[model samples]
Target: MKKSKRKLAAIAAGTVAAPLVAIIPATSAWAHGYVSAPMSRQAQCAAGVVQCGGVKYEPQSVEGPKGQRTCSGGSRFTELNDDSKGWKVTDVGQTMTVTWTFTARHRTTNYEYYVGGRKIADISGNNQQPPQTISHQVNFGGLSGHQKVLAIWNIADTGNAFYACIDVNVK
Candidate 1:
């Protein structure tokens, strides 16, 4: 009789404590916080399919202030708003890669790549090729060891293009 009561109590305690135990670790991991990249400058093309797009480095990090933000750190606030094509940035800690893809319909367009506001690679005039991919790996160049990279794209033309951005941590 006494054993039965004790067993029931133990079961009830386990059921209540198990959930609490699981939740604590999850909450801690969630609170670790996230960081974001700097910034990239972008603009539409004036003549050809491609235009000048520079990288902008925000000298300071952005504190959350108060509320939680979907993005954190000094990420890129500049972007290339073109519905035709796609632009993406992949940050691999040591090296950051930015990729731009466009269709032949977007010929005469130009794209400029930069690291820390310094022009790194400039691709001009689409070769009138079919939908393709163009990518460049940028060396942050004596950065602060590990840099949160930000990439920007400028759709200088009105044609069609696909764009995406990704961040990869090498360390």
Candidate 2:
């Protein structure tokens, strides 16, 4: 009887501890998006483009503060911003298709792409859902050699955004 009771207690503790053991204290309601194509930093972690800790399971959950051009999602995810992440650079032409994979389809305002800290393209999301993947055609006309492009999916109702940095070798 004591062994059974101890097993039950352990099960109960594990059930409670599961939520607390996350790298980020994120609830399902808040995590919304990540760029899948061009393989954003977080997506790279998911795709094994680089070695990342917990982000491999939740690539779409990079919920950092607004106006920051980082892929870390800020704070606990700051390792994503490290310059030596060994991220694989994708090769592309003047235009590339960026696909965003969402876990929770939040109302979205728009999608923006930046290269060398300059806004290159601004596309519309306008609060959509399901269907899983969102794709945008972005032009990298003025960029050459190697560049890191910042892709953002802006949440409509909140001041949050899903940030991704994609390394590319422009052809």
Candidate 3:
């Protein structure tokens, strides 16, 4: 009788843990988007252009609280914040089209672009879900030389945002 009781408890624990294990991967899937063109750091990781950690698996998952300045959005992908990581820099004109690829679109507040910690452009999201792919024309405003452009997607209904850093050489 005692052995049977122990076996039943173990079975009950496994049953309770099974669903939780199944839900773990689903949480990571909640990540929505990333800059594809001009190939953001995460995009490089996903494309095997750069060797990386877990962010290579989910390039769109570099999400955290809004109003962040770092490339990782204060997430666990600190690798994104490493400027020495040998990120690829794309060459572009003074005015270039930046594109984003979405895995799961969310209602958006606005899209913002920054250079040297200064906001360069702001495109209204109109609080709507964007298409699977969207592009914006951003003028570097005569800013030249190597620059890191920080792109942020603010979700309208959530306090979180997705982040991508695009390294570029303006010529």
Candidate 4:
């Protein structure tokens, strides 16, 4: 019985260790929208909406000041900023899903979700909860090719936005 118990323990350890060992050190898995750090790393897309990492945004980042979009869509007053840490790309396929958690002030907060720079959805509310989790999944005609997804958060009290964009190459 003792020998059998030892064998079982060894088998369990191998089960856990095998997966860890097989993971390539440099392999990149899809993560929600905080880009890979060191600040210089970035992904680009054509002139439209794009999803990258865990967040989505309209237009490519290469445009810099010109590419940024307002959370409410079609405005030049203020730009997308992340007070609640904005949305992140959770998964991508025929339908792509993006999610993020954030805290809001005592005022009304407006969150807008977008695909390819077009406003797809939005939620607005006042003084209810913090660390609110917002998520969206869009079916792009069943993942025929590349699709762009973006989420931008706008707090009424503060005119800044937390925004991220990603380019999903659907398979």
lDDT per model vs. reference: 0.36, 0.81, 0.94, 0.42
Show where candidate 2 strays beyond 4 Å. 1-28
- Pairs that clash in candidate 2: none
Error of 4 at 149 (Å): 1.7
Order of candidate numbers by TM-score, starting with the best = 3, 2, 4, 1
Q: How good is model 1 by TM-score?
A: 0.31
RMSD in Å for model 3: 4.3
Question: How much is 133 displaced in model 1, in angstroms?
Answer: 2.8
Better of 1 and 2 by lDDT: 2
- When 2 and 3 are scored with lDDT, the better candidate is 3
After TM-score superposition, the amount by which residue 100's alpha carbon in candidate 2 deviates from its true location, in angstroms, is: 0.5
- Per-residue lDDT for 47 in model 3? 94
Error of 1 at 167 (Å): 5.3
What TM-scores do the predictions have? 0.31, 0.79, 0.84, 0.39
lDDT per residue for candidate 3 within 16-67, as digits (tens), equals: 9999999986664474999999899999999999899999999999999999
Clash counts for the predictions, in order: 20, 0, 0, 25
Best by lDDT: 3
